[model samples]
Target: MVPAAVLALASLLPVQSSAAQNHAQPDQPAKALARSILQQLIEINTTDSAGSVSATSKAMEQRLLDGGFAKEDIFLGGPTDRKQNLVVRYRGTGQKKPVLFLCHEDVVEARREDWTTDPFRLIEKDGYFYGRGTQDMKDNDAILVTAFLLLKKEGYRPDRDLILALTADEEGGSSNGVDWLLKTHRSLIGDPAFVINPDGGGVDLQNGRAISVDMDATEKLYADFQLRTTNPGGHSSLPVPDNAIYHLADALERLQHYTFPAELNAVTRAYFEKLSTIEHGQRAEDIRAILKPSPDALAIARLSAVSPEWNSILHTTCVATRLLAGHANNALPQTAQANVNCRILPGHSREETRQALIRIVADAAVSVRYVDDAGNVHDTAPESKGFPPPPLTPEVIAPLEKLAATMWPGAPVIPTMATGASDSVYTEALGMPSYGISGIALETNDVRAHGKDERLPVSSYYRGLQFYYEYVKMLSGGQ
Candidate 1:
């Protein structure tokens, strides 16, 4: 449920924002509303730092209600005031599968000491909005809500219904938000033809180029593994050669030494081939040759020659992120544990990764246990052909691709794989084809997502608002 504080305050504001809505033209009013609402939301501490989400949910709910959504169409069902999920619906003509535009509301804690301005408040400087969740991704939320509200006010009945979910705890697991919704409120999210999450996109090849549309048809599944070694608890005064610390360290070292086999499936192959076409000079030739079957040696040579970030995309990676051992400085500790986060590429399973780890460690002294099994695994013959790639139905992709061509020509539209996860995982798991499209036209240098002083380019955010309107119209028209 929404927090009393937010609801009480919302009850006092004008129930209908028609006064502000009437000030702008119908075509541009949605974008204006998006900007206005985003500025208001930036004022709230939506971060879970306070361990409560009622305030944020209420603010969001009120914003939607005032924007034109019916009160019953908005929902708030979750644990308590600390974490509440928001769902708002817009009516449409019953002609196509309803489209679901998903995003999260909760943001990671921003370090005030590290930021130039208060991260909680919107700081407009030099045309950009400096605030947390601007890119990762309050901008998308604002644009989406604006699109729905304006469509409702204009009485534009879409061919398909529009369902909007502003989930909680996306930075954490989905246990509180999407996961619960899918399980408990399945009917609310009708069997969608597909979903569009505005989290994944490609860097522009150059300035003023069409932002490469990186449609993530596939993503790496994460499996967390814990490595532990036990030794007798003894005084620090009496040191042993094979103590828990040393054993755990050796296991980590071994893990570092061994690398999971790099397997390029159809998606990666298609991705690189497209990259090969637009990329210039030597890089293009090397990339093109790597797409050929039996190009392992050539691919490895080329990948290793490039940056580590690029290398990771060509392979499965494992990194030890958390280490746990002794509690007291004086104690040597009887047990030591390390948490290894592994990102397994497509065509592999958690079990296969586990077995690979066992081979790497090759030590009986250290035991491996999985913390969370995120995906199911199945064994298939290495030579057997797998399912064909997801069909790019023109009905869903044409407008998006056209926009890309218009915005960025000859930019090599590639079907890329997301190294990180997104809310699309839920829709994809539900058997609906999903696309992650963010209209933000960004270069490769921008990096503040889940980092210090996150900011969004003013042009990109505004353009995204336009993109949403165009996309909704195209899909609803079946163009």
Candidate 2:
């Protein structure tokens, strides 16, 4: 399913000359290769409509093959045709278990009309790379590929094999890339010591300077519940108190007033402990108070109400996203439905969240039920419970902390819990400790991962390249 234009572009890519390959300083060549790969990926329109992940995977597959990788070490298949994943292994001496590098090839849909320039085209302007996946990812994918190829060229042997999985549909669609790979091709990844995912972690910056390298060791659980109310249809003039839309509205109002209790885990505790040092005044005081064995109730309420992000990190959150009611303009609706999305904390059960919703609504006419990933409605609880947050073991954090000091100098490496979800959830669920360390730095106010005009600073992109290059080398025992 590779697009003809992408393949044509791939065929036209300039080959690295012998002189450039032989140069003692390989940083230039590696950066060029990374840029080339990133541009090609961005231009392919890998959205669900105009582009194919299979195409992107094949393009990267060809790059590795051209760099002298054996065909057998590279895998290009997924559950579906257009949604194929690419897994490449760079074999080592087998002194240790393999290390996995994961990045999704799929991106959120972007329309040409919504962007200042073409979303599918990589435009370098104002010292930034403007595109949909530039900041969300694709930058990490390019860096990983470039590093692998450069290391191969250098003949740097590792104590363990390094596996790279460029996957599809991590941005909300059918057939998640990581889920499919885990269920179908677990052996390809093998039982690695842990996984390095660049999807969740990032360097938080202020005024173009890094404050800290945030490593997300855990993520909130994503679950959806459908709130529905049914009533007999009636004429507009004969509206009754038992209207479905009104019942649903009242339930949602009650939910808006409800808030989950504040709690803290190891990751959040560390996050606040570090964050408190940088903040001042009441905000800093509130952060420190929350870290106490018994947090101040007033401080928790003040902090939670002041910021939605703080609220999400402190407690599970459920909010109505989509609503549907009347079939006709002039008729009382026979049914009303609302989709309530919840980001539950680790160890929380889907059943527990659903039951809480039922209690909050407290309406016999309003029924709450779980909605499966495929949009199927089910009255029963999920068969599987939410996975607990992974422990921040020394094996993962030590190298990260050491490298963060070397790379950014004085920027504290903070353990974080992602309010958003990532493919790491699937790997962690399979008992493989997964950590999100995208190795890219982003200003806190400048994140546009799924939004329009998404971009990454030109300098930050290269910094990420160097960061991951060394980090991967150290972890893989090439240093």
Candidate 3:
């Protein structure tokens, strides 16, 4: 027998009738519009060093205006002349609060030399869309823009408002668009029923087969630390044992050999448990062994060695991302510095990680300092843990399940945490429940968001486009 409270909660959520379950997927016009928007966005450089995200925002705002949205409903503003954010709202019947669809327009810096094709140009060859933001997500930006336009064309009003926010500097910068908006213009974004972010979460595919539809229920904390050592310079012919470069290099070598202890929270523990059921043979056994109270050392080592994804899930990871030294070749370096980037697990604090790094380095000569987003260096960091993950309410999960059943029949929807991070950090920080759910599917081996030759399969892009349209309709109680 079900409890009375459980039944009451179930009755509050809107149920999808058989008639409401189906809708036209991405038709020809929708595909063309999405493709055009994506190409335009790609060709316009939004990189941190040289690109103008402010211009990109204005261009999108014009598109919305041309599509019949009033000039008053669209907003464009940010901290600076080059970095701007766009917020557009679609009116509704006022039955519920708005749903915020947050996507960042800025992408990681891409160079022409690093990729086979120009990273700035949208090239479709061999069944894939090759571009910088194709995978790390201009695709979702285009998808959401197209969905709103199509809805307006159909004259379909929903039970609640739908808001889309395209912003700057999610990849890397001081003036984060989401942070600026929340601080300066919370009234525009307004209160939301919830936030659906497409910056993370994806369909996991292995060997071209659907493994699971993963949702980023939570994410690791991002922190960067600077390691520095200084000493008196000397001529290359007169070398000394006490050298800055040697000290810094030795500390980094120790860091390379060491790994953080295995730590798992509620989300990751459940992730491994669900993953064990899908994975088979020796791999499955290793996962099960690691879940034990005293997990086997060999199993942890073997699994962590083979997959970086599993390694990140199981432990806090820190690696040296940038290094600088040697002002002159003829003289000993007076100073040396390196940037150690870390993704800390949820329970640990940034300060705690810094303290651990100091211990691992075991050298007083090499000083560790915390580096903030603004490039400010400090000796200490905050003791607070990462944002607590919100409960997976039925209202959020039900629609996802219903849609996934029709699209990928055998795939299970699994809740997992992001190994890296996204702009969801800004919204979730405000106590607004944010979830990362994108319909795009990519192969596990071909995962290359920030790497060379970043591409999304042509079929996958269109399918994801269709999925977001149907998904928003299902969430908003639209026909």
> Mind giving the per-residue lDDT tens digits that candidate 1 earns over 109-211?
8878999888888888897889988877777878787777766767787887788888877766334477778988888887877777776654342333333
lDDT for position 321 in model 2: 92
lDDT of 1 at 429: 66
Give the per-residue lDDT digits (tens) of candidate 2, residues 1-479: 00110111222224434442232333677778889999998887777655689999999999999998999999999877889999999999898899998999989889889999888889999999999899878998888998898888888888899999999888776778888888888899889999989987877765555566778788888888999999888899987888899999999999999999888887777767766766668977987888888899999998777766778888999999999998999999999999999998887888889999999999999999998766788996665665666777786788888887766655667777888888998898889888889678777777888899999988788878888778877887753
On residues 1-479, what C-alpha lDDT tens digit does candidate 3 reach at each position?
A: 00110111222223434432333357788889989999999889999899999988998998899898989899999999999899999998989889999999999999899899999999999999999999988999988998889888898898999999999998888889999999999999888989999987877665455556778888999999999999888899999999999999999999999999997778888877876765667877998999999898899988788677778888899999999997999999999999999999988899999999999999999999999888899999878788867788777889998888777655667788888888888888888888899988787668788899999998788889888988899889955
lDDT of 2: 0.82
- For model 2, which pairs clash? none
Q: Report lDDT (CA) for all predictions.
A: 0.69, 0.82, 0.85
RMSD of each: 9.8, 8.4, 6.6
Using lDDT as the yardstick, the better of models 1 and 2 is 2
Candidate closest to the true structure, highest TM-score: 3
In order of appearance, the predictions have TM-scores of 0.85, 0.90, 0.93
